[model samples]
Target: MNIEYITTEELSKRIRYDVRTIRERLKDSVLIEGIHYIRPFGGRKILYLWEPIERDMVLHSGHHTLAIPMANGGRMNG
Candidate 1:
């Protein structure tokens, strides 16, 4: 499958989520590294994977939905 690479702004636009939210709240929490996102050739810039994140955004956007695993041994349900 040909994966689509998306920058922060592009992703935020499509999902209606703020870029800051994606970077601050979602990154490394709901969004996993190397799975849902990737950095450019040793660069600090992280580009989110469009397809997977999109799918996940739909799947996990809800109240009382502990869909994603948190790093602190907790779940993000609601």
Candidate 2:
């Protein structure tokens, strides 16, 4: 399996989000570690996994209703 790893700057460009937003808002909130990103060798540098993020973006897109994510990995639809 091949994974495309990208930096925060690259992710910002691909997702059309600001670098600060990705770093501050999205990271560890909407995008999770080990799922959407990883710290290689347990270092401080973060590399975002492109495929999972893209897949999730498409999956969650086109929704008119609001859904809040729960801590148990479920969503509370609103």
Error of 2 at 2 (Å): 0.9
lDDT of 2: 0.93
Where does candidate 1 stray beyond 4 Å?
61-78
- Tens digits of per-residue lDDT for model 2, 1-78: 999999999999999999999999999899999899999999999999999999899888844458888999887898
Q: How would you encode candidate 1's per-residue C-alpha lDDT over 1-78 as one tens digit per residue?
A: 888999989988988889999899988998899989999897999888888986776777653354678899767765
lDDT per model vs. reference = 0.85, 0.93
**Local error of candidate 1 at residue 42 (angstroms):** 1.6
- Residue pairs clashing, model 1: 65-77, 66-77
lDDT of 1 at 36: 93
Alpha-carbon deviation at 3 in model 2, angstroms: 0.7
